[model samples]
Target: MQAAPTPVLLSSTPIDLSPWLSALDSVSAAIGDIPALLSLAVEAGRTWPQPGGGRTVVLWELLASVSAIDVAAARVLEPHLDAVAILSQSAQAFPDIRPGAEGAGDEAWGVFAAEAPGTRLEARSAGTGTVISGTKPWCSLAGSLDSAVITANTDDGGRAAFAVSLRHPGVTCEQPEWIARGLREIPSGSVHFEHVPAVPLGGTGWYHSRPGFAWGGMGVAACWLGGAVGVARDFRTGLSAGAEGGREPDQVSLAALGEVDRTLTAVLQYLARVAARMDDGTLGSGAGQSTWSEAQRVRGTVAAAVERVLTLVGSNRGPGPLAFDERYAKRMADLALYVRQHHGARDDAQLGRLALKGDCPW
Candidate 1:
């Protein structure tokens, strides 16, 4: 008998992500149920956007959707989304590997490319294949993901990417390394690859130097912006519904609300422009702004927007929402953890250096 064909995943275009959004809401409100979380991940995988016109559209929509629900869930989902985006670009970068280019399935994907000095994952050439051995930290969904796009040091002292299966015989994932109360569901830890067989993805310097790599970094900002929006919703809802308890919101509270709206609006517009530029292929070297500089610039801007939203929400709403509303509290905490992906003053300094060289492509 012939095997059954894999069903086609839904196109995220004409994007209606209500089901997954609802799932996220349920998971966030409830105290982090593992089964529910897995179900949501599956939904996300199935609807993961393919490379096309609506890619960035689906990205912003999904980030906002997940952020509006819960950031921990966003944390779980973002890496998978990033992995897909990375692999999608890698396919073009190294067409010879024929890496799987399909959307979400039972086999989830993550990107594990964090580098540790003196502990690089060396790729050993074996016949027409390669094997990776070393420790990779900051690996999200380490044990859970079926496959991933990992980076390794090639024998020639250059870097290369590999598609490695987690279930391979020599692989071992270190559990419970991610002990933070926020984003606790995302098991970001270390994974040990001991002679794990793999398929090479791209050549030396390709993974970091690619234009899409920077574009993908900016995609992360979209998720952070969405999470901030999610947290700000509590403030919006509460202020509009009257003040905490029964008191009317004062001028101070109203001012805070204004700032929240302005911050989110600016960040949202910036994200839209960046996404459009990315889709139109105008976010590159000759476009007057290198993708790397553009990504850093936007990431920094969105990161600041996230801070402003959090500050405004906290100061305006006070602690009532944080103490009483479980969802609001979780989102606030989650957003706090997620935005730390930005490097703060260091990133700002890098942008300053880039600006001194030439005009930035915004």
Candidate 2:
């Protein structure tokens, strides 16, 4: 029989895929259902934005997509983490899959699906004159990842990014001993590197130098939205039970659930509107401002509101080991911590710029 050709993936332009790479880095055993995405495809996660266009909603679109990717990656790597050569092949798999982030930092990229916050990932100069190393936190799929998109202070004092495999020399992983309570599934550890060979990305600070990087940076809202949605679903389960038998639900629980529904809805709408604008390129300069307000910066507002609902139900829903019972309590902890995962200080600065008069205030 003739040899069969392997199918190849192709796209028109080079894109920054660090976002999705971040997703691949997050999948793990904790990832709920890997095949569920295929059987019950999520409309929101399927279509990512292309250069000039994409999906209609903005909130956590990337994060949600990545979260899904985590599920997929988990399906592939969780059982194989103990395999040695498996890690090498895993690193090789990433450069091909996330082709869009060809030149991203090695910190964000991972060769395997597993790793650490300060995991050192380095490569010998293929004599390609490349060197890479650095520290990266939030490496969700650290122990399983194959490589990393890293940033470091270069020899000349400027910053640089490169791709490196964890199996390479000089790479080390600093696993976070304690994982955050909420979003407990995302295993963001650490990575570190020392004199690792690397292929330099375009230049230093490439993380934010590109256009739309701001829009690209904080799309983590979608994952937040997913967890929020999950929380709401869990809450709804509680509410339905609490309202069972027409026994008159408690007023405080009812009221709290209502507010959680209301606030999350508003935030999701904000995400949808801004995302549409971004897709059509119709978003004005202030788009960043609006997105920040809804998607992040003030994400604490959503977090706080969600917290209110969870606390209300957890404390009053009548304890047990059922799904809507004690399990819901865990999600409460997850959301509480997960909600605060974004770059709050930076988002605050952006929001601050709009609130106060600055030299280039919007």
Candidate 3:
């Protein structure tokens, strides 16, 4: 008789990573799924920032990996995390960033938005030296931010970005009034800088011209993918609980959940492939208009996937706050707001604009 074939087994299990740190301690001594593995890197980046490697892809990968985690983590980790590694890593990730004049300070990059009705940050330059002012709405690493990348009307009457130190007596982080849904873990508060001394990272128009200006968006697609996994986990948990309670996971619910899972999975593949291309130098133009267009499409897909999950889970408020079934509500709220950074408005508009130009490959 032929020896019994090894049973093919599959589990829809989620691993609690807090317990396992090394590859040796990984669950079942097996490589965890990409989502879980990615999450570790993301959280690690947040809790243990590598300050010196600022210009390396590793720095941005860390940031982008955990970019979607709420602001709360940003605050908690600010004190404990290895900040020096983060800066050093960022410098390496984007080697183009320059050290300021001896007295001039550096600024932290945050993603609230552009073309918004706000002036949380401002910067002015005279020759090589620059003075920055105003408040930043959502400075990601604000508490520990060396400074804030500020924009303001110059004396000559032109808009500009200036690197302003947060330690300066002129700058202050205010209460974050509108706590958006998703990335609440970050210290996304407003900051006001008054006559803060600063230095231009590049020439008068360097910051805007940086390749990362658009690269940031594409990298963040991974975060959305993470959120999608979170949603999937939540969905599965809900279904299991409902099943245990003898409630059948209706067809509509299963279908909705599945769709969200499939769509998000597709985009996740897209992000990973494109990211690899970027690493390999296959995908040219990090911050070109085309990059923006593709990012928008991915963002829209993520948004839709989240919304589909929300709908499948139902909207009727259940007993107490915890009892309500808002499947991915918290995450969705965060993603809805975050996705706009790709310049995405509606589901259709994601690839709509791109269609006008031409079809895209995968």
Candidate 4:
């Protein structure tokens, strides 16, 4: 079946993402298969536009398109693309860091940067290089992916990013007994690094300080937006089917659909504006408070919009689809868990603080 057309960002130069949509559609049925998803991510990493490049909009659109197909695919693909972007930024910032030449081959990569209490990954100088040791938590697909751009604390009390091979003898990936119903195929388990050799990507505290960090966060919002779109699509499909069956949607359902369309349209426009700003350097490259505030705003807005979409979809469609349609049910569950990455009220409070400090654009 032909893939549904991807939403085009409002740009002076129109980009044709139909090819990517078609490619993702070909493997839509194998959504939960790790190998197939990894293969697609590798292919996309080879040709997809890097965030903050001139084609930032295209990069996000591709992410959203993948999410629209399956949230699990986005779960696997977003971090891979983010890893590529991080490596690219690192290479630009540090002359000695060569992405491909630094033992980071053309294999599938993930970003394992999440840290947990009482668990730490330390990066220490080992002769002319560095090695990371300890446990890194929330490492999604760590066992399956070939490499990762992980963050580890340094001896100087600062954190830095390193590209390390997951297949090394010093590395141990724990089997995840993940009980989460959503994103069941993609397990986020911890990996222990026993002095695993690593190539430093950038200088101290450069991973989270880079401007691309905010851009990457916004890219995740794009995935949320896309997943919501997928849910909204199911609602639309149900409405159309009902109409064809001579059971037209009532005023309440039509109003819910209208609200969904309005919310998605507003978020899409906001994302386009942010992407353009990022590409044109209007968002600044210093990872300033303003950049972070904008990212927080985008994430919070998208998260709220997604929540509304899920609610509308549930209320309008009732429990029939949730109970019977496996794909739709999975989409709903995956998106609910995925958008929680936004941190909801905590993020809103951060934004509130930023606004009070005059960091936000109002």
Best TM-score goes to which candidate? 4
Which lDDT tens digits does candidate 2 get at residues 31-72? 454333222222212233432236434224444433333323
Better of 1 and 3 by lDDT: 1
**Compared with the true structure, what per-residue lDDT tens digits does model 1 show for residues 1-362?**
52221111123433255444455445455446654565566566566664234567566666666656667766666666676666767777667675765533566678888875656688898877788898888888777778888998888999888888998989989885566767777768778999899877678788898776786677678778877877777787787677556878888888888888887877777776767777787766464567888889889998999998888888777788788988788788878888898989999899888878875744
Worst 10 residues of 3 by lDDT: 4-13
Model 4: lDDT to the true structure: 0.86
Instruction: Give model 3's clash tally.
Output: 42
Q: Using TM-score as the measure, what is the rank order of every candidate, best first?
A: 4, 1, 3, 2
* Candidate 2: stretches off by over 4 Å: 1-52, 56-128, 183-185, 284-326, 343-350, 357-362
Indicate the worst ten consecutive residues by lDDT in candidate 4.
6-15
As for candidate 1, its clashing pairs are none
Using TM-score as the yardstick, the better of models 2 and 4 is 4
TM-scores of the models, in the order given: 0.86, 0.62, 0.63, 0.95
TM-score, candidate 2, is: 0.62
- Evaluate model 2: give its lDDT: 0.45
Candidate 3's C-alpha lDDT? 0.46
